[model samples]
Target: MAKYKLPKPGELSSSINYNPPAKDWMDIPVEFKPATYPAAAKEKDLLTVGFPNAHQWTPEDEDWNLPDGWEDTVIKGIEERLSKYRSFKLFMDVCVRCGACADKCHFYIGTGDPKNMPVVRAELLRSVYKRYFTKAGKVLGRLAGARDLDADVLKEWWYYFFQCTECRRCSVFCPYGIDTAELTIMGRELLNLLGLNINWIAGPVAACYSKGNHLGIEPHALKSNIELMIDDIEDITGIRVNPTFNRKGAEILFVTPSGDYMGEPGIYTCMGYLMLFHELGLDYTWSTYASEGGNFGFFTSNDMAKRLNSKIYAEAKRLGVKWILGGECGHMWRVLNQYMDTWNGPADFLEVPVSPITGTRFENAKSTKMVHITEFTADLIKHNKLKLDPTRNDHLRVTFHDSCNPARGMGLFEEPRYVIKSVCNNFFEMPENTIREKTFCCGSGSGLNATENMEERMRGGFPRANAVKYVHDKHGVNMLANICAVDRAAFPALMDYWVPGVGVTGTHELVANALVMTGEKERTTNLRGEDLPGKEGNE
Candidate 1:
């Protein structure tokens, strides 16, 4: 149990101040106020992944129990990373302090904390880089904006780095294209070296390392969970969906975030997958071994991310499936698009993905050999492969939230909208600035979606919620649709706090809602068991 409690919306919104104070940002010391941040990683969770200096500690304590020569470890880690990644080095060296990205961060807009500005957040690390690595800093000191790395500075790094969602919205605006998310990644990596990780992130990393999923769900439990969803699909549509697990010789190996296996609204999306696959008669099998598509290890370090990501290709080869089909997850697609091929390799064992229903070859994913679900569904809609009745979802006026990673990380902009519009009749976009590549984060991303950090999540999500409020007021929007599992999990709480009447949903859930399955009984309700607009009286 945590000490933090969420405040009333009025009080919470009133507390924010967007303007910076008269004092310099450097002089503003880090504060460990209760409820503002998440708890420290437990020793057991840290030990599960063999993180060094694993010990019980709290951020509020005066002594953080850092290992001896911890400063040397962080400095060496920075040096090694700077040499290994050219982009990191370029980001460290090329910043002109132009402030082009200052206002782009959601946290800066919500909380008005100057350090939350992407530029200042990077400077927290860049200043340390200057003091230890740069010659100019060795001579000029303060004039060069160099600062010593001490206990306070390390605490500041932990405080601010976790505040970032690593959405890359700021990078989209940077002239030098500085990825502040990468900087936060580096900061978290350095922190993990000292076992200074939050429980939400460290727990999932450890679970995914050993149990193949973030929830630590075992093979049997994973099967049972999907089985439960199968039963629900039968009740709603009067058609039982039989999905195989860990079955070899399947044409496609389907992978989705484990949240979709059980979490609300996400499970409906999972039901959507089951319904759609049955309709197409697609030869796909679910893998308990590669049960998770979302990677929390990506938030920890490069090595950990690689270690967890290696499972997918390994399962694909073991099951002898062709190319993989990924579900509606944000960072998962980012990892698959950018890092997986580089970390895991050419995936030469897998063939380029060709949709069995539409026969559309995904040339963009030829190297990774994995296709996003929206890309597959959009192709089906484009080819008129599936029988869709958009009127089924007429009760809901919907708006699309372009998830952070998919939009900016992979440039997956139009595919999901195409799918959503094809399934739901009343489709509306969030304000232009808030959608597509320049979209805002759900604030709970990058492993910050913990109970104790509720205040920060709400504050960081304010800009996005504000935009939703805009559409809600004007168009009577009732449901928020997105592709990310994190968005599915996070936005329900976000909308409840900010825009109460609006509900959160997945794109595939919308697809399944409108999908007219063959031999299905007379449908009285949507996948969620809610009656359709005109079917309410019939039910």
Candidate 2:
């Protein structure tokens, strides 16, 4: 049985005012109407600033003043760095301003401001690039309205680009197929160099640098926590789930976010994996040394991100694991599938994974033979490898909330859905706009998942919660199923505040419910074919 902890009343003070007679940050009245766009006036229209750009673009403003004697060196370094990728230059040269993607952003929908449109968001970064790298800016100077790097422009970059969740939702609707997420990433990287980084990211970045994980839990602490979880599992099921720690010569090494060891919903998923692996008798080891592969540093700088990724390969080499398996995570999978193969690995010792049961090979495998938990589970089910009872999940009227990272960032559109379908019968999907490749964010994504960003979260979270509210009202949907650990950790608070009584659960939780026995009485359906298995008083 799961342990419960009741929340104390008013335990943590909120910065945003949520009630009438609003006090400081806690109770401000919500503006139900959408924000307005900047209205166009008479100009030659050589440069088109969108309607909502009016708020952020102060044309009267002066350029940023560089620190003494560093301006030329900084400019030259930016040029060199920008030159490394031809794609960045291709992205910059390809905007026609057709306004096709204006309504495609969750932030734009929530705010109703035209500038929050993904096109405009990309423009914020592109304009700066044009000024610094192009011949027109260097010769025309002030006449071209492109100036040197200044504190004001850096501040604007921090404010607007960081608002982007980098979900790649914008890419689908762009006529030119521009990806604003890439722009936002590059913008954040440049800002990190300027030392204007957000505190939430900076804290995690420093922690990841010094302590090997974003949460700063050392190797000893990670082992201790996993051991506690293993003990709890054994005590519940009388099944020993031994996860080898830092063991050399293991066939497989597993890595996950440190949040899985420390946080609630994530920990439950951790238990589910442990239970499943024990049942399958898989050979794997967990390394406290490379406890995290989800680089929060990726949101800040490439140098720090490269360093973080380097640790995963280093630890894998030390363990001599022929392959690695990724836990159910959002950005971690994206980083693994998209970059790790080229960034830090050429693991000549490792080969593509083959199903032990079917003898079929994963011909398209990337670095260290990484696979998401859902794909593994779905494959196991396909091979008829596990015993499951779907009736155990009748209590949950669940719908899948495809996490933005895995759904859109990586092309993992089918695996999680396959896992959900195999394990539960009561599953449903949210509306098409809020599902799969078109899914909305959990609001506090991209390292903004902090108590300090509560107000901003509410502002950003409005659109996603509104989508959920529509489904709840229409179909009485009560539960959300997602795969990403961060979505599970962050969405609950948003639901509690905006749409009261709704709950979120990870996809693995439902899987565990169907399989694992917790030493408590198991629910049984009464005859007459009624849905009474998990009715009241069962717990």
Candidate 3:
């Protein structure tokens, strides 16, 4: 749209630059200029969650008006976290600065910002850790790569930390097994100490805390949204289905991210979920409360994550369900799989999640008693539980982009592809390295999917988008499928920016399109209301 500083003529490969300019890291001027997208937290958004320091603020404002004892607050916060999480201490201590993981980051590969590199991003905190805690840093100082926690350092943390999508792709390449995501989370938590947070993250967190879901959809609105979805279902399949809400003694309690009830692609995916469950005759009730599976809380802090995630179990127990069927989401599963059991409880009330129809036990989710939508669909496909017409998606040349958290954090790589391949006729994977655990982020994961950060999101999204472009050109791919809500929300912009012809959607949205329901009217359109490829102009 405008003439920007174009890259040098020969700047072709991302491998071209792994080393920063020849200067001391601290002396290197970090310019958070027009290139850096600035988005600040809104007071109204934070007010619901009772953020005491929440007031009108902007990233461009010079006076952030941090608390009086801000330096001490940060030091103490780091100390407490270090003491609590051994992983933090180990990550701080273990890095050898070999730069093996440097090129692996999506932001660094996309923006060429050295600080975006996982090693250097961690160094933002690691420098503070060395200054306050480490012995070598106390004596050697810059020689030991330690730096002070001054204003500039704080600003740098705010800038680059959000640049990370908390995608652990870097961790996959690290020889030391260092996780930059954990460091990024620690950075965000420390920044939140000074009441510094973005509006996108703070807003959803507050909404989820009070209104039961991230979009702040209350009981009435939640019911209304589903009513609209049921209307759409009837229009397509010629069958009206009734799903329960907060009904006690239900066999399964279904929960999806709040975005599913409100946002695009997500709402379409939600329609797919409803139609699939209706066809299976699965006895499941919905919950107006705990309507979110994508935990924005996980992006904030462990306490906030625990606070928001507590609803799922609370609602499940209240509804008297045997197990929870979680929808397709990114960080939500990471929390559900890794943190929920440890943070919330043994969940002794709910029974282990087993498919009552197929009788398949999810032993991996035995502790949490939660099943992923893909896993559920895969099981159903394996059993031929639903008649699927893969040819319905013949026009959609699909490729799967593994969302970072579920791919790296939980290792849910195969189940989603199995479901996608089972539902769609043609399937392609973005290069071998970029498809599975080493997959890049959507450039807008965590809480970085704000509109103000569009430019930065475009840059961070390049690696993932570039891979999509490769597949788009080679495989004639048009539909880029994923299971993450953030991807569904953010990738349209990315697709338009980098890979213009390609589109992003949820895996189950495709399944719902291809599924042949019992005694349903002959379908002429897919879930998005698009005419089916071959079904067009047919009597």
- Would you estimate the TM-scores of all the predictions? 0.96, 0.82, 0.94
The CA-based lDDT of model 2 is what?
0.69
Best by lDDT: 1
lDDT: the better of candidates 2 and 3: 3
lDDT of 1 by residue, 310-375 (tens): 999999999999999999999999999999999998899999999998778999999999999999
lDDT (0-100) at residue 441 of candidate 2? 81
Decide which is better by lDDT, 1 or 3: 1
Alpha carbon lDDT of each predicted model: 0.93, 0.69, 0.87
When superposed on Cα atoms, how far off is each prediction in RMSD? 5.8, 12.6, 5.3
- Candidate 3, residues 189-300, lDDT tens digits: the string is 9888777888889988988888888888889889999999999999989988899888999999998877778778788998999999999899999998878887887777
- Tell me the spans in candidate 3 whose CA falls farther than 4 Å from its real position: 1-22
Best by TM-score: 1
lDDT of 3: 0.87
Q: For model 2, how does the per-residue alpha-carbon lDDT over 1-539 read when each residue is reduced to its tens digit?
A: 99898666665456557655525211122221222111111121101211111122221235323345444544665676668866667788788878887887888887765557887777666656667887886788655545556555555566666677777787888877788888788876665444445556666666777788878889888888988887766655566677788899877788877778887767877877777777777778888878886787778656667777888878888888877777877888777777776788786767577655445566656444776778778888787787777777766577788888888877788888888888778766777877788888876677777675565667677778887787777777677788877787888888888777677777776676577443433433221122345464542
Candidate 2 lowest-lDDT run of ten: 45-54
Clashes of each: 0, 14, 0
